[model samples]
Target: MAAAPRGASAADFETAATHAIILDHRSGRVLFRKNPDEPIPTASMSKIMTVYMLLEQLKAGTLTEDDTFVVSEKAWKKGGSKMFVEVGKQVRVGDLLRGIIVQSGNDASIVVAEGLAGSEEAFAERMNEKAQELGLDNTTLRNATGWPDPEHRMSVRDLARLASLTISNFPDYYGLYAEKKFTYHDIEQSNRNPVLYSFDGADGLKTGHTEEAGYGLVAAAERDGQRLIFVLAGMESARERATESVRFMQWAFRTFRNFKLFADGEEVETAEVWLGEKVRVPLVTAEPLALTLSPDMREQMRVEVVYDGPIPAPVKAGEPLAELVVTIPGVETVRQPLLAGSDVARLGPMGRIAAAVGHMIWSAE
Candidate 1:
C-alpha cells in the first residue's frame, strides 16, 4: 500500500481492561496496539501455547492420535469450557484434541501437560521457557490451564505471535482449530472460537474469558488469497471482540499490498560463494521475492544488486555468484541468490593470460 490504512487504538477499546492489538498474522506487521506490551491474563487463550507444545510430542512420534490416555480424576474434574470427559475412561489423542481446542477444556490441557512433561507444573515451567525463546518479553506463565490467575499474563502482541507460530509451524494440526464441534465421551461440545461460523475466511486460534480478563480472542481470517490474524486481548464483551476482529481483517486487506523488487536472477545481486575458481562469484536468488508495503513506501523503495563481474572462463553453471536486494525502510531487505546461467570451460595458460588482459581492458572502461 502506498498510503497508510485507517488505524485503531488499544485505547479505543475503552471497556478493555488491558492492552489491545491487531496484527497482520501473515506479514507480522502490527496494525494497532494499545499498551501492547502490558501483560494481562489471557484466560484460556494461553492454551495456544499448550497446543503448540503438544504438537511437538506428536511430531516426534511420542504421541499419536490413536494413543489412549487414562483419564484421571483430576482431568475429569477440571472446570471451564470442558469436553465433559468422564473419569476412569480412555481418551485418545484425537478426542483429547477436541476437548482442548473445540472445548478449551482445562482438563484436557492439564492432561496433555502431564502426558508430555510428567506434571502440569513441569509443563508450565516449559511454557515459561518457551515464552523466553519466543521473545514474549511481557508474557508470564502461571499454569498449564489458563485459569484466572493473577500472574498468568501475556501481551496482545505476544498472543498474536503465539497464534502465528501455531499456524506457520503446524499446518497439519492447524486443521483441528477449524473443527466447530467435538464429541467427548458421548457429549457434544462446540468450539468457543467464534470466528469459524460468524465470518467468511475466519478460522483457527483460540478465545478467552474471565470476570477479570473480560473477553479476549485470537482469530485468523483469509480473504482474496491474503491471510490476516487478529488479537483483541481485553474487550468488555464477546460482541466487541468479534466485531473488532472482522473490522481489523478488512482494514488489513484493503490498506496494504505487496510490491516486487526484481525477478530472481535479473542480475547484479550479491551472494556468497564457496570454493569457486573465482574468489567471489556473482549471485542470484533462486526465486523472486516480494514485500508488503504502505503506499508511501514506493517513494523510498530502493533495489540494489551486486555480483561478480563477467565471470572467468572457469565459471560453471549453477554456481552461486551474487545477490539481489530489495530494500524498504523499517523492514529487512530481501536477498535472493544469483547464479551463473551457463558454464565456462577451464582456460589454458594462454587463454588465462588472454582472459586476464581482457579483464584489464574491461576494467579500464
Candidate 2:
C-alpha cells in the first residue's frame, strides 16, 4: 500500500475564518487544513447529521416523502429560523426536509425528530449512534436542531467527512441542498449556503451560526470531472464566512491540478542482485501514481528508490524489495512499495567463489 501526502502548508493563503479544511473528493486527499481536528461548536451544521439520519431511513424503505408527521406544540413554538409550520397541522416528510435544509427551520428539525424517534432527546441519541457508525470520533450531537447546546460540537474534519458521505451515499436526496428557495405555508427563504448561489458547480451541504459557534459552512463543489469538499468555522461574521469560502474554493480549483506522476508497470529504477544469474531487477509500481499539485511545485517533486543494496539471491518475481519515496517542497512525503520485476537464480559454486574474491579485492581497496 502507498501512503498519501499529509497536507500542504497554507501560509500563503489568507482567511478570516479560524478553522478550515479543503479536500479532494475523488482521491480523499487533504489539500489544505487549519486546525481541522479541533472540536468546536457546529451550530446548525449538526443538522447535516440529522438530515443524514433521515436520508438513511428514506433509503432503507422505512420512510417515505409523502409520509406526514403532525407538528407538536414544541415544534410550533421553537425559535430561530422558521418554516412557519402550524401546530397540529400534518406536514409531509419531504416538505420538512426542505424546511430544515433551505430554511434552517428549528421547528422542522424538531418535528422530524419527534416523528422518527418519539422525542428530540431520543432522536439526538440516534445521531450520536450514527456518528459512531460513520467513524466520526470528534462529533457529539445533543439535539437535532443544533440548538446551541454546550455539548453539541464537531470537528471541521468530521463536518467535511459528513458532507462527502452525504454526497456519495445518498445521491437521490442530495439535491435538496441545491434548492435555492423553498416555501412552506407561504413563508419563503433562500438557501443559507453561500457557495450554492455564488459559485458554479456548487451543490449541497449546510451552513451554521450562533453566538457560541460563530459562522461556519460545510460545502462541496464539482468542476470538470473533479470534486472538492470544504469546511470552515469560527468566522467573525456570515459575510466573512461567505467571502472566505468562495475565495478559498476558487483558489483550490484554479491553483492546483491533478497530474499523473507515474504509469503502472513503468519501471522507476533497478536494484542490484547479489550472486545471482541476473545482476539487476527492475522496480515498478503496480498502480499508477497520480497526485494533485500546484504548477510551481510539480517541478520540485522528487522520486527516490530506497532499499538495502545488493538484494540476496533467490529473489522471486513480484516480490516486494524496495520503496519509492516521493516528496514535494510543501507536501508530506509519500512512499509506495516497489516490487521485483523478475526472478533471479543464485550463482553456482564456482561463480560464487569468484564473486567472493572480487568482493575481498574491493574491500581491500
Candidate 3:
C-alpha cells in the first residue's frame, strides 16, 4: 500500500489490509479508492445499515424517540460490545440508538431490529431494501447487529456510499453516532471508534472487529468545509486500522481542493436557438456542480461548453439548451445540462425578423 502524508501514515499500520475507500461528503467526489469493488465481509460495519433502517422507521412515525421497548430475555443475552441492558428493563428508542451507535451494542441493535420489524430477519429485509434505494448494489444483508454472518457482505466503495447517504439524508438523527458514551441501567459504555480521539476532525462513525473480520471502521471526518467518509476493512489489528484511516483522510484533504463548476441560476453562457422569439437561450447546470482538484493543476484547468446550444426558442422553462462540458487536465470530462432559466416564448413576427437579421449578420461575420 502507498504511504500516507506525514501527519497520517499507514506506516504505523502493521496490518496488510487490502481494501480502502474515500469520498468527499461535501463535493460528492471520490478522492481515492483501492480494491474498491471487491466484495468483503462487512463485519460489524453492518450495524451502520441497521441504524439507517431504524432511522427510517423513526422518520415514518412507526417509531419515536420517547417510545420505550422492553428488553426481552433474548435481547439481553446478546453478546458483544454492550450498553449492559438487563432483561425486563425498558429502554427508550433514543437511548437504544445511542447505545448501538456509540457503544456498538449488539443487544441494543437486536432490540431495535425486533422492536421495529417484528423480527431480526424481517429487519434484514428492510436493510436490503434501504441499500438498494441508496444504490449500494454490491451490498447484501444477513444480520441486523453487524454480527458475524458469512452471507452478509458489502464492498468498501458501497460502504462509503452508505455512510454518505446516512449523513446526507438524515442529519437530525445521525447525531447519535457522534456521542462518545452512552449510559443504560446506570452503566456508562464508551464508543469503540479510536479515530474519534486520535485524529483531528474525526467525528461520528462506527468501528468493527471479530476473529474472522479482523478490524474495520466506517468513519467520517471534517476539516474546514470539507467532510470526508471512508471504509477500512479486513485489517490485522485495531490500532493499525485506526491509524491508517486517519492517515487516509488527512491525505485526501491535503491532496485535493474543491472547485465550483457551476452556480444555480447563473447564465451558463449562451447557446444557439432556432425558430423561437430568441435566437439563443442561456445554458446552465441544473444544480451547483463541484469537483476536486489537485493543488498544482487547478490553475491550468479549463471548462469547455457544448451542445445544441440555443436550440429552438419556443422552449419551456426546463427546456434543455446546452451541455456545459468540463475538461480538467488528466481527468474524466463531466457534462452538466444547461437549462433555459425561464420560458422563452415562440417567435412573434418581429421576433422572427430580429432572429433572421441577427443570424444573417452572424453568418456574414
Q: Predictions ranked by TM-score, top down?
A: 3, 2, 1
Reference-based TM-score, model 2 = 0.81
> What's the TM-score of each model vs. the native?
0.79, 0.81, 0.85
Error of 3 at 292 (Å): 1.9
**What value of lDDT does candidate 1 attain over all alpha carbons?**
0.73
Order of candidates by lDDT, top first?
2, 3, 1
Against the reference, the lDDT scores of all candidates come to: 0.73, 0.87, 0.76
Cα lDDT of model 1 by residue, 1-365, tens digit:
11122234545344333566666655576656677778888899889998888887788888899997777788778887777767887778887777888889998888778777778888888999998998888888877778988888988789888888888888888988899988766788877777787778888889999988888888887776566667776678888777766665566566656555546655454333322344444454566655555676657777777665554446777876666566766555556666775555565677667767876898899
Which 10-residue span in candidate 3 carries the lowest summed lDDT? 1-10
* Candidate 3: pairs in clash: 271-310, 272-310, 273-310, 284-338
Error of 1 at 32 (Å): 5.4
Task: Mark the regions of model 3 whose C-alpha exceeds 4 Å error after superposition.
Answer: 1-16, 273-281, 296-300, 314-318, 341-365
Q: Which candidate is the best by TM-score?
A: 3
Candidate 1 TM-score, true structure as reference = 0.79
lDDT of 2 by residue, 294-335 (tens): 777778888788999899898998899999888988677877
Worst 10 residues of 1 by lDDT: 1-10
